[model samples]
Target: MNITPSLKKVIGLCLPLLFSISAIAQPVRPKANWQNLDLQADGMFGISTEKAYNELLKDKKPVPVIVAVLDGGVDINHEDLKNVIWVNTKEIAGNGIDDDHNGYADDVNGWNFLGSKKGNVEFDNLEITRILKKDWYKYAYADTTKLSKDELAKYHQQQKLSRELNDKLEDARKNLDLYTKVKTVYERVFKKIGKQEPTLEDFADFIPDNPMEAQVKMVTMRELPKAKNFKEFYAQSIIDPIKFCNEEINYHLNLDYDSRDIVGDDYNNSNEHYYGNPTVNGPTTTHGTHVAGIIGASRDNGIGVKGVANNVQIMSVNCVPNGDERDKDIANAIRYAVDNGAKVINMSFGRPYCTDKAVVDEAIKYAMSKDVLLVHAAGNDNEDLDKKANYPTPFYNDGGHADAWLTVGASGFRDDQTLKADFSNYGKQTVDVFAPGIKINSTVPGSAYVEYGGTSMASPVVAGLAALIRSYYPKLTAVQVKEIIIASVVKVNHNVDIERKGKIKHIAFADLCRTGGIVNAYQALKLAESRAN
Candidate 1:
């Protein structure tokens, strides 16, 4: 079986991370320092994607690479993404028996750690919500069966957990209602400023090198058609305050977090030989599908936007949920991707609380052992990771350096006006680079597409960039790619233009983030080429 397919069949591999490739139409004489190039204007955003494709092809090579997406299932049948699925030639599709004997019965595309042979993934939360309310009806709050004194005490203990969860839910519901009210008021005020959309249309494509436009881009206003003050409207119009509040509530406050009670198995071990099915996609694969499209969606597919890399293979490793992901599943997914021949792993999700570190931490060590680069999201929380805590970090260098893991944060759409998004996490201690993450148009399930924002979107942009470097340079170690991304990021505007309190603040962008820059493929190519020498 020729597991190494032709590079032409691969989609994202064509993007050359090195300048010497066919894509580098006019290269400068080689130099020692890594070169940098601006990509926002020269990028493939506004112009026809085909024209961008040709320019890239002139100095690029299409190579196939595998990126493991440890998130909700990926939409395999997406219109712009159908051609890039990583098919398993080692085993026949839909075979009841494990033909390849790799433990999974028939992983045609990749394994789904979250599902079974029936292919369902709408599982519950991390903490079970069932115990609450039901037991509230009980008088003695005991199972009322033949129970010893010790057993009776245990029953009450579990019942207490139920009460705590219901209280948490009540608080969350109240918070949501409050946020919705604030957002509705702002929506009306923002409309008086601009008649068309809720967002500041005046902010679009206005690349301001000056400070005044940047001013109009940072102010927040109350619920009134106040004077057309760009600064006041920019703050409220650009951010979805309710969405941010809800995401925070969902992760931290949900007391009945364990929604996975239906699986009927222990999550602490890997003893189960076969747990999932070949029909890997689930009901809600929007997040993974969006990330995948950003990395390797087929170009010139006559439907949607082009992916970052040109020729690459996408493998589904469904593990994370809408809620918190377990350490065991994450650890297993990384090992699985490495053992199955993935050169790059894109983990666009992160959690603050990980009590069990053995399975996933060992998996990180295993990925390093197998020479795979792991790209992870730096989280969406606006706190600085240096002072704050974030997991799945790449920094093992005690003396001030990075490891094999690269953490990326979200960069806003308008690079000039308060370029740093209000929701993106930043840190000189951990975060390596920033990328376009605001309202990105990407693939969704069933031949559809939608715009989403998060470090989830940023991680795969770097992952695709990693694929480009691996395909072109081939000799660069996974650790080296991590360094290149960090060192080669383009320093964008130093504008502090985000919402805080009831108004927008104008601060330097560099002050908000560690790198104070965004990822540029053009510059990364030059850096990769110069460093190779």
Candidate 2:
């Protein structure tokens, strides 16, 4: 089947909606249980977690398995998640000392890498920005004739980074101005309407005499219909973008910003282990808590959405910040999780580049040596990861890739030509499998729940299944668990339309990933049970 130019434009616009939290909040399909429904039976293309728990593991007693949530932070006090959080038995809580002598003090639940003895690190520059700024003097007035191969390469990288950062900073400034303008108009027009919730018809009926009012009326009438109500429209269009611009301007693109000063650790020292505090759930725990809820939110508790693994304990390991996670923190977080007995580790964050790829590679190798499974998000860039690199990838810095690592792409609820998530990054070699990521309902911070969409959400679904498998089949090695997941995928036997080169192209879904299918909890468990020792 060939895609028309018009259809391609539609697909391109539609795909990005999967990544926008506000866009997917009110889906087209009402009463959508698509993420939880069985694909083979219901045509929803989910992991069939409920079916597996109800039928396959009905009578079996599951051994408790610890899965690590390595992200910004996890809300340990979440109403639905408090019970399933991992507790360190050997280490005493709030003693002001390292009772277990594990180099961390008062780590009752988990350690926070974004925090230090002084305070929390709120924002950080990208790894590339940091590297470019560090070597600015060396490359600023470089003699190309006298430069070595490595030095020239570094110079070129710095040039590329300088351009990218300048472009992003300029774009962010424009967006902030545009959003601020639109917000002022929205507020003025809304006041004139004299209603809490104004509809498109209300805007149409509103007569704007002034030029400023006319601009607001035009923009609001055009874009307001996409939202469910006034609050959502204001939040999504005005508030969120403004906040994002502020972060970009003040934090991400700020080359002079040093979060390590607050962290008070030598970030270059990969061996500096004990520098963080016991604040597992930092200022914002929404992302990490949501990932944790997807992996091991208590099943049969009747409080919130059920996690994929019922008998699993979530170990929170904080490292990520609002912008980019440092490689040193990521390596230490992975090592900590592995040393503390996490069989499966879920990393839902990634950057376009890394400054300390070698350190991260060593940590991955350490996890692999410990027979631990690492599951990572394929990223929401909608690009081919095999062609373009995503940092902290399956590929190692030294030589080979991590064998036990599973990179996952996001799968939508639909089982049609557009089954693959519009925002998912696909690669035949890079991404191993797919899972539910569109409009995923999970736990948020403040003991609340919300729907979020990203490869970040998709990763923990696979990790939860890994935990479920290891819980029942305790003797199966991490390598065996990885194989079972990739082997037992429910193949999508159809040609799907995916965004490529800014246009929609019809390609076989099987070709999008190595597994060519979505992750199936039921099938994975069946495969694991067959091989269980």
Candidate 3:
């Protein structure tokens, strides 16, 4: 059972195909079911949780609940989110010192594992970066007495890739900055020309060719306030991927190995604890803030959308950085949440694969040991996960998961089973359930609210439902709670067809996910009552 650091590297490279699953789109579904189901009236929260909540209210079990959100940082100051922030009793509020011994001090709200420094975010490991650093040599070359040609080929591939990534990262940074600048300029000009929202039809006679390439067009189009013109301006500002590729090749890829660069800890000693204080929280919370609001922003405050869990405390864990989350930080975050008392967890992030399998596995195992129900997003890549292995999977690195883990995918406005979102990851065997994901409005940083997309939005929907179940049916174990969620969804439009393998393929709702249907909170409570009877 002793795995060296080198062995972990080999498995990561060879297992590129490990979690490669297809995300097929579903066919047309009936809209009547959606209309007949009063998403508002059905739930206690007066909002659709995909399942009605009012029915769950019959049992009359409501308590202050807690859900951990693992994502980019959350905006603690958001108008909708400022009220329900999880307070750490062990640590003092807003103090510079770590009085509590919870490892992360001053985490009064949450942690921001990914700090706001743009350059600080590391790039994902691509084939190219492995070459320039020759870091791949240690993993691919176990013995130097006899080297394989394949090894040499890999080195060459890495070299070529390193150059490309360096170029990519730099270009990406510049383009991001440039686009914002150009957008500002364009907005300024568009407003001066057209005080009100204008239409693209207004410019039918005037066309800007190679619009995206034309900086002039970007400036003019952005100022127009019309829906069509706004779309046109958006299209014009799109930067070419070429710029980002070259920069990534130069900076992060060509850089040397420095594991100590991020958190300033000795990564060599995984058992060495007491390196951090408990007073950590997020700084740039655009993504996490929105997700928190979806799970438990104060409802009916006459501001934003209703959260699924009414009386739940949201312990914002700042584990995910702007890039992929470090296994060590995530592991620690899991333990922190569990040690502090979190029953339901929501993870809205995933990497292409797990770099540190042991670290991730142990953390997930630890969470289960506490009987926590962990829910995760199926990813936004639109690939099938049945075969493809994404990082932080419900199952351990070995592909066998302990119960209490649920993998959720995105469902759209369409009611048919065939209509899996064009952006959602699907697997008849791997994914556990589905929820609404399109155009979700949630809280953001600076007390603002904006609509966002991706299965990232879909995850909180289920986590909230899981909380509601636990709130009403406290007798149910984590495993039973997962089962009730999967077994009770209404299979109204079971048979549907959607895109798969570049062609339309027919499938049943049960075939799309392990659960076979979207979550129905209303049915869940009814089932819980029956079990009690």
Candidate 4:
């Protein structure tokens, strides 16, 4: 599977210590596959999902649980995922009418909130960008003479956003031009050297006569030594810069464009529903398909990696886009999943700003009321969630938080220096637990697989564990399951080093999250069995 440049930016920015395919060639020990393994007599951190299935759930009549993948979209036809995909018996497939009369016409599997009657929206600006574009004057250049406290606060926010957007755009444009020029020079020098892979010695031996030739030689001389071959050099100098430039040019800085128009929904009206297409796998299925496979890809299929849960059905809910997911769409997606019998909802997308957080908050409460569990990614930005807000959070306006919601931070396989994922956001109060997210191998759009990492990957691991717990126990409430998972965490009793503000600081692992430990499925099942007895 080809990872697009923009996706790398989106996924990479979210995660600070991402392992690129080109970067890490050697595989770590098999035990480092923490997401799959169970804890042995030796102290290792893992969910122990497969171990539980083998020892406990093998002979048991496991109940099937519905887990929702609410993200970009999912490829319902992926080889390992085909049989596990949820099918709606009440609604007929390809029938022009609403068979179930649920406002959606022919939604046999799931709904696509990111698409419309016209087509699907692939890319969009962030909500902060939209705020800057629409309300620039209110905060861009305000007079301090006669302003209320609320007005002054808003003005400051607008000014900050404007500065960030402009600065990023300028940096991207400059780097794009620099990379383009460097690539042109590097190619010409390689051709002159008459080698497919040029070396520094080759450049030093050849002398240039003209100004253009001299410039080419200068750039190649400095760059060739860093790369072992021409392919690596071209990718770094040409591919990465072009990808960055294209994203800035086409979406982020493109203020005049609005992808929401394609959806044909009243963006201002949070109450308005029933507007999207039935095509769940809109434009790109890479992100969402990978997420779903982690939750419950068919076990013993002999094709792809087995998911956490063995007896589960995946409901694809398309609300996230290549860019930011709107608050309205997210709220509706949650409500739809809950109403359609999704017991566990996994949201792997979020942004720094939200247009209408109240609606989303209300939807979360509604899910809680229905006994549905929401597992969210703690975001890739390595910041404190207690200080900075990641939208679609369980924190409500009523000054209370949702009981059935779990905010997960990313963890690595090792329990030493690289224990926590460098890019994962941590919070002593806001975030609940940690899970394996580094170099996760999962299913992509085609009948292929790839290694991707982020808190996005971490969230689904917990969601899959939730499904596994509910499937085996069958009597645990959403809140009870959340507590069991948190209570059963394998606590890290020592201090760990973490990078913050460009400096490594030794802090207690307990300070990183409310639960100072990682989620353990074997422990959780043991607790559940005790509680049941």
Please give the distance, in angstroms, between residue 205's alpha carbon in candidate 1 and its true position after superposition: 27
What ranges in model 2 sit over 4 Å off?
A: 1-27, 30-33, 40-43, 143-149, 196-234
How many clashes would you count in candidate 1? Answer: 34
The ten-residue window of minimal lDDT in model 2 covers 4-13
Residue 122, candidate 2: how far off, in angstroms? Answer: 1.1
Better of 2 and 3 by lDDT: 2
- Candidate 3 lDDT over 1-533, as tens digits, reads 11111111111111011111222232222232231134444321112443445444644757777788876556666677767777777777667666676665566765544332222333333323433444654544446345488866655565665566556555556545654565465455456446333354443334444444254443333333321234432432222222232333443334553323545566555554444433234433567777788788776588766777667788887666433456666777777778778898888877553446687688789888888999988886657788785567777767778689888877655555434655577898889888766545667777765555467777888887788778766777777888787877655356655555555567676677877667766777677678755
List, residue by residue over 176-206, the lDDT tens digit for candidate 1: 5654654554455446445434434444433
**Which stretches of model 4 miss by more than 4 angstroms?**
1-33, 39-45, 137-153, 174-245
lDDT of each: 0.60, 0.80, 0.59, 0.78
Most accurate candidate by TM-score: 2
**Predicted model with the maximum lDDT:** 2
Candidate 2 per-residue C-alpha lDDT over 332-429 given as tens digits, one digit per residue, 9 for 90 to 100: 99999999889999998887788788888989999999999999988877789889887898787567889999999988777776677776788997
Q: How do the predictions measure up, each by TM-score?
A: 0.70, 0.89, 0.74, 0.85
Better of 1 and 3 by lDDT: 1
lDDT of 4: 0.78
Candidate 2, position 504, lDDT: 66
